[model samples]
Target: MTGPTTIGAAPYDALLLFSFGGPDEHDDVMPFLRNVTAGKGIPDSRLAQVAEHYEHVGGRSPINGQNLALMAALRAELSRRGVELPIIWGNRNWAPYTRDALIELRDRGATRVLALVTSAYSSYSGCRQYREDLALTAGSLEEELGHDLGLRFDKVRSYFNHPGFVAGNTDAVVEAYEQLRARGADLANAPLVFVTHSIPDTMEDASGAARPSYRTQHLDIAAVVAEQAGQRLGVDLTWSLAFCSRSGPPSQPWLEPDVNDGLRELAAGGTTAVVLAPIGFVSDHMEVVYDLDTEAMETARELGLTAVRAGTVGTRPVFVEGLIDLVLERAAVERGESPARAVVGRLGPVADACLPGCCRQRAGVDSGVPALCGQD
Candidate 1:
C-alpha cells in the first residue's frame, strides 16, 4: 500500500461500486426480495409474483453480472489512467452487502473511500435510501468485527446528465431506431418512449432541492438523448416520458403513463412503431427484461405496433470512459485543482452530495443528515 498522495483533495484509497443487488439462483429469490422490501410491508404473496419475473429467467438476474463487468472495467480504466486505486463492490439488497464491503475496506486498510452508485438519478430509492443505509452502517461497525473500525465514505455525484451517459443513451436509441427501420417500422414519425422505474408521486415530489427532482432528472435526460438521437438519425423525433414496473397498492399513485399504456396511446395516435429507450436504468435488469422485453412486447403485439427496447449503458465503452472522466474531475476538485465538469442536460450533474433535506423518505426517517461524501 502507498501513502496518501496530495494530488486530490479527497484522497480516497479505494472506490466502492454501490448497487441494488439481485439474486443469482432459485433459492436466493425470496431472501433477496425480503431484504429489498424489508420495511415496506410487502407480503410474500406479492413477492412471489415478483419472483416470477426472476423465475422466468431461470431464477437469475443480469444485474450482478453487469455490475461485475462494470467493476472490472473500472479497474482497468483506473489502471490505464495511472490511478492506482482498487475497486470493490457492495449491494443494498443481496449478498456482499454494504456492511461486508465496509469490513473488507477496513481490513484492507482503506480509510477514505468513494462510491459510485449504480443508479444515476435522484429519487428516494435511488439516492436517499442508500444514504440512510450508509448512516446505519456507521453506527454498527462493532457488530462486524467485535470492535469499531472507523472508515469514511463519500459518493460520486449522480451522473444522469453526464455527457457520456447521454451519448450512451443516444447511441442506443439510434441503433434501435435503425434496426426498427430495417424491420419495416416507421422511424421518422415513430414516437420515442423514454422509460424508467415508477416511484410514488410523493417520493418524486420530495426528491431534490424542494422540487420534483426525480421526474425532472428523467425528463432532462430524455430530452438530451432525444435531441442527440434526432441529430444522428437525421430526422426530428417526437418523444414521451413513461414509467414501468410499478409496485405497491393500486390506490397509491406512482409516475404516470406506464410504458404499456404509452404504447397503446401511440398506436391509437396512428404511430406505427416506437423506440423504447430505458434511460432510467444503467443496466438491463429484471425490470427491463420482464417489464419491457416480455410484458411490453406482448402489449405491442396485441396493439399491432412495432416496438423495440433500446439497450442500457451496460459497460459501453463511452459510458465507462465517461465514468473515468467523472472520477478524475471529482478527484481534481478534492485535490484543489480546477477542472471542467461535463453535463448534457439542464439540471447539470447532481451535487457530489445531496442537500440536507434532499430526497427525504416518504415517512421521513430521523437518521439526520448522513455524514456522506458531499455532506462534508
Candidate 2:
C-alpha cells in the first residue's frame, strides 16, 4: 500500500460535508427531478411521471434533514474530542451548493478545506463526478463572483473497511435479523442477501483500485457481518450480492442478479425468509425508500419471500466516530506522521482517500471530460 503523505503544517480551515441533496416539500419535487435528470433525453412528461414517486413520499426526502442532523452530531463529536475544525455542509444538487459553501468558507477566511463525500465506492458518479463538481464550482466562483478564491480541497478516502463502518453495518444487519426472529420467522433457515446500487458493467471494469476490486469490498463487509451475527445467534448464514436502482436503458448492461430477480430465485429455492443488508449505501435515499422498500418489497411479496431490508449507516454514533477517526488519520499523515492502522477485524484495510486516476469518468465527445452533474 502507498503510504499516506505527511500531514501539512497548516491545519485545515474548514471541513466540508458534501452530499446529494433532496427536496423537502411537494412543489420542490419537479425541480429536484429536473436537477437529477437534466440530460439523458428524459422528457418533461416522463420527469413528471417520475415526480410521482417523490409525491407519494410527501414530496420530501428525509436525506437532507438527516444530513443536517449528522452534521450537528459530527461537529459535537469532534468538539467533544477536541478536534476544533469548523464543519460546514454543501449539496451537489440543492439549496446549499458547493459554490455556496465555497463562498461561505472563503468569506470565513478558509484557505484549505477537507471534503468528506457521502459515497463509499469507486465509480463515475461516486468519485470522479464529485471532483468535477468541485472544479466546476471553483471556476464558476471565479467567473461569476469575481473573486480569486485560492482554496485547496482534499477529499477523504473510502472507509468501507473501517472498523466503525463495519461495526455499524453489522449492528444494522443483526438488528434486522432480530426483528425477523421476533416476527416468528426462522432465522436459521433464512438467506442473508446483501444489496447495493447497480452501476454499469463498463464502469465497474474501468474502476482503478489497488486490486481492481469494487464488489469485493461490499462482499467482504457482508461476509464479516454474517459470520459475526451467525456466531452470536448460532444460525447458519449464506450471503449473496444483489443489485438495485438500475436506471439506464435496457440495452445498456448494468450489474447482474438484480434484487427482484434474486428474490424470485430465493423463493423458487423454497427459502422462507431473506434479509437485505445494504452495504453499498451510506444513507437511506430515494433509491433505498422508493426502489428497494417499495419496488423490491412488491417483488418479494409476489415471490412469496419474506424480505427484510436493513437500515443504512447514517449518523449512527459508530459511523460518526469512524469519520472522526478517518479525519484524524488523514490529518496525521498530512503532518508526516504515520497513522496507526485500525482494522475492522472482519473487513480489510480502509482507504483514506482515492488516488489520482481512480474512478475515471467515461470520456465525452466534444466536451472532453465526462459530463458531471448532468449536463445542461
Candidate 3:
C-alpha cells in the first residue's frame, strides 16, 4: 500500500469508538442518571434537579448523534482513501454496552482491534477508567462465550496536542470573533474564554506531571488557539481558561473560575464582548448545550454584554483526518514500523501505551483497579 490504512487496519482488524453514553429519550433519563452516578449514592430527588436539564431539552443527549456523525465522517474519509474498515461503537454507562460491541467485533472475525475514546485528554475518568471498562467487558464476554475469542484491543494515543485539534479550535475562535464583530461588538477589549467540563481539583492534581494534567491540557490548547486567533485577527487575543458542569458535593472543591462566575467578573471588569470556546469536548454534548448555551448566555444578556459560543470540532474534516492519521500511525507502530507522531503547541506526543501510573484517580494513588491497554 502506498500509505497507511490503504489496506485498511493492517494490524488491527476493526476499530471501536468508545464514549460516555447518554439517554436517548424522556423514559431513559432517570436510568441514565443512575447509571452515571451509581456509586455516589445520589438520591433521585437530587438527580431529578439534574434530570431537569435533560428534561428541558426533550430528555435526550446529543452525544449519541455526535458519535454517529463522527463514525459517518470516518467512513467517508476511509472510503475516500479506498480503505475498508469496520467501525463498531460502545459505551461504558448506557446502551450498546462495550460487551455487545466486542461480541460484534468477534463475530466479524476480528482478532485485533484499535479503540478511540471520545475524550482527547488523559485523566482517570477519561483514560484509565475506559481502559478498565474495556478489559472488564471483553473478559466478561469471553466468559459468556466460554472461550477466548482471540480478540485483543489497542488504542491510539491521546490527540490533545495534535495539530488538527489545535487548528480546529483556532478556527472556531477566529470565526466567533468575526461573528461578534459583524454584530458590532467591540473587539478592542473583549476576552476569549475557553471552557471545559470541570473535574474535581484532586483529579486535576492526580493527572500527574509525567503526562499533561487535565487542566494543563486545556491550558496548552487554549494558549495555542489564542495565539493563532490573534494572528488571524491581527491583534493579541486575551484569553483565560474557565470551567463548566461542576456537579459534585459542595464540600469538595472543583476547578474554577466557573464560567458564570468568570462572566460576571468580566462584566464587572468592563469587558462588553466575549467568545466561549469549548475546547475540552469533542462534541457539543449536554454540558456545552446547557451550561454555555442556556445558563451562560442568559447571564451574558443580563449583564448586557455581547457573547458568542464557539463550536466544538465535531466531525470537522481536519479533526476526522487527524483521527485517521492517529489510527494509521498506531497501526504502523503495531506492525513494528516507525511512524511520525504528529503534535503541536507545548507537548510533543503522548505515548501510545499508557504508563502504569498515568491518570490516577487521586494524586499518588491508583484506583485499585487493573487497567488494560497499557505497557505496564
Candidate 4:
C-alpha cells in the first residue's frame, strides 16, 4: 500500500476509487447479478439470462480488474504530481465493497476523502446512483459501528467533457477508422456510430436540470470526439448516437434505436462499414465487451457491413493525467484557490458541485438525503 503524501491542499487526505464491481468467476455470476439487480424485482429467469452475458466473458466482468489497475495508476500519477495521498478502492457491488473500503479509510485516520467514480455522466445510474451508494454506505457504517467515524467523502466533478477524456476517445476513433480502412472499408462511405447505455426515457428526461443531463452529456461527448477525429482523418465525418444494453420489462420503454438496429438501418442505407465509438462509457466493461463487441458485431456481420469498435479512456495516459488534474482542481477549490477549471467540450464548464435536484432520481425515490459531495 502506497502511503499518503501532501495532496491535502483542501484538508482531504485520502482518495477513493469507486466503481461498479463484477463477478470474477462462473460460480460468482448469479450472485453478482443478484447483487446488481437487487431491489429491482427482476426475476430469477431474467437474472439467469443476464448471467449468460457474464458467462460469455468467462463468467466474470473485467471492470473490477480495470478498477484495480486504475487505482494503481492514479496512485502513481498522484505521487508523480507531488500530491502524496493514500488512494483506496471500493465498489457498489462484489468484494471490497464501499463500506469495507470506508472502514479501511477510517482505520487509516482519513477524515476527508475525495471520490472518483468510474462513471463520467450525469444520470441516475451513472452519477446519482454512485452518490446514493456513498451515502447509504456511510449511513450504514455509522449505524453499525455506532460512531461518526469523522468521515467526509466528496466526489470529483464529472469529466465527460474533460480534454483528456475527449482526446482519448478521439484517438481511439481515429485508430478504429484506420483499422476499418485496412480491412477494405471505404472511409468515404463509413458512418460513425456513437453508442451508449440506454436509460429509461423518464430517467433521461430527469437527469441534471441545471446542467447537461445524461443523454445530452453523451451526445456532447460524441460530437466532440467525432469532430476532433474527423479533423485528424482530414474528412467531414457523418455520425449518429445509438443506445445499447437495454434491460426492462417488455412494456417499459428505454432509449432507442438500439445499436444493432442502427447497424441494420445503416446497411439498408447502403453504408458499407461503420466505426463504433463508445464515448458514453469511461472504460471497457461488460456492456462494451458483450453488447458492442459480441452482440452488435454479430449484427453487423449478419447485415454484411464491416464494423470496428473504438476503445474507451481506460488508463490512457492523458486520461490518467486528467484525473490527477481534477483532484488537484478540487483540492484548490477546497483551499479557496482559484484554479482554471478544465473542460474540453462546448457545453461546459459544468459545476464542480451539483445543484439541488441536479441529476435527480426518477419519481418515488428519496432526493432529500444529503449528498456527500457535489450537490449544492
* Top candidate, metric TM-score: 3
lDDT of 3 by residue, 1-376 (tens): 3443435468787889999999999889899999899999899999999999996678899999899999999988887776778899999888887878888888899988899999999888889889999887877877888998788888889898899888888888889999999999777688999999899988888886458789988888888889989998987889999999998899999989999999999999989999999998899999999999999999999999899999999998989998988998898898889998999888779999998688877877755676678864
lDDT of 1 by residue, 1-376 (tens): 3543434324878888999999989999999999988988988999998898997788999899989999998877776665678788999888789888988888899887788889988877998788777777866776656876767777888888898888989999999999998998767888899999999987877785544488888888888888889998898999999999898899999989999999988899888888899999999999999999999989999998888889999989899989988877877777778788888867656666576677776534444555455452
Poorest lDDT segment (10 consecutive residues) of candidate 4: 1-10
Which 10 consecutive positions of candidate 1 have the poorest summed lDDT?
Answer: 1-10
Q: Relative to the unseen true structure, what is the C-alpha lDDT of residue 301 in candidate 1, on a scale of 0 to 100?
A: 90
Q: Which portions of model 3 miss their true places by more than 4 Å?
A: 1-8
In candidate 1 the C-alpha lDDT for residue 322 amounts to 90
Off by over 4 Å in 2: 1-10, 209-211, 344-353, 363-376
What TM-score should be assigned to candidate 4? 0.96
- Reference-based lDDT, residue 366, model 3: 58
Error of 4 at 184 (Å): 2.4
lDDT of 3: 0.88
Cα error, residue 157 of model 1, in Å, equals 0.3
Per-residue lDDT of 214 in model 2: 63
Model 3: per-residue Cα lDDT at residue 37 = 92
Q: How do these models rank on lDDT, best leading?
A: 3, 4, 1, 2
**lDDT, candidate 2, 1-376, per-residue tens:** 2332223223677788988888988888888878877777888888887788886577888789888988998887776675668888998888788888998999899887888888876676777678778878888888886877988777777777787888888888889899899988999888888888888876676564433456766777777878887887788788889998787689989988898899898999899788988888888888889888898889888887888999988989999998888777777776778878676544455455554445654322123453232222
